[model samples]
Target: MLRTMPLTKNLTLEQINHLIDTGHAFISPFGLNRTAYIVINHKPFMVVVTDVSINAIQLSGSWYNWDELEKMGGVFESEFEALKAVAGGA
Candidate 1:
């Protein structure tokens, strides 16, 4: 249970640029367009970039951070996949 999940990390410059370069479009659970970023937190998470704010999901507690950039996202999932579509793009 991801009770009161924390917004402990913010996207770094490197991570942000990488996301802008490789962020893949995905349909949110709400069926809107969003971009997905693989965030390297204590564990790996799928961060969904929306027009208003970013949302994240920890899929099965797996950890996978990209490159020299050390960044983090959030937790849990009942929403749709944000990490799925971008697995190969980055």
Candidate 2:
């Protein structure tokens, strides 16, 4: 059976990694050289893993590149942290 991730709170870094490593995260092509792994939560936030290198959390609207997002304090140490930072607009 497929394991369902809980959406009550932000996922941990380990959990995000597991989702990517186990091919459970949704995969989407970003560009010719990049791929995105997306994890959606019940809340208004979503965590996106880019080519296994960077993690970006999108609360809503369009996506932005790492450089542009970093300027807005959107960059984080991990997917979990990114999600936590954006949770409830914190």
Candidate 3:
């Protein structure tokens, strides 16, 4: 569980951003309104990005394999900026 996993505590903003930017799964279309996931962790944490203009971001969705994120670019700097701009808008 999250309480037992030390990695959860090690999770940093930079790391989270990196995971979003270059992660195996990039920002893809989610719904008719251009929704997509920007997170790379299997801990019920999913960063949702909608209305890129406002840069709305939110963490929702079920848990997935965090390791999967490493397989991709592993994250990017832009993702960090966007996430902060919207404060991961819910």
Q: Best by lDDT, which number?
A: 2
> What lDDT would each prediction earn against the true structure?
0.36, 0.46, 0.38
- How well is each residue in 3-51 modelled by candidate 1, as lDDT tens digits? 5232225857776567557863233332223434443443344444333
lDDT for residue 45 in candidate 3, whole number 0-100: 26
Order the candidate numbers by TM-score, best to worst.
2, 3, 1
Residue 68 displacement in candidate 3 (angstroms): 0.8
Model 2 lowest lDDT segment of ten? 29-38
Clash count, candidate 2: 0
lDDT of 2 by residue, 8-54 (tens): 35888898889779977764323222222232332223333333223
CA RMSD per model (angstroms)? 14.8, 13.4, 15.5
The local lDDT score (0 to 100) that residue 18 gets in candidate 1 is 72
lDDT for model 2, please. 0.46
Q: 2 or 3, which is superior by lDDT?
A: 2
Ranking of models by lDDT: 2, 3, 1
Model 3 residue 90 lDDT score = 27
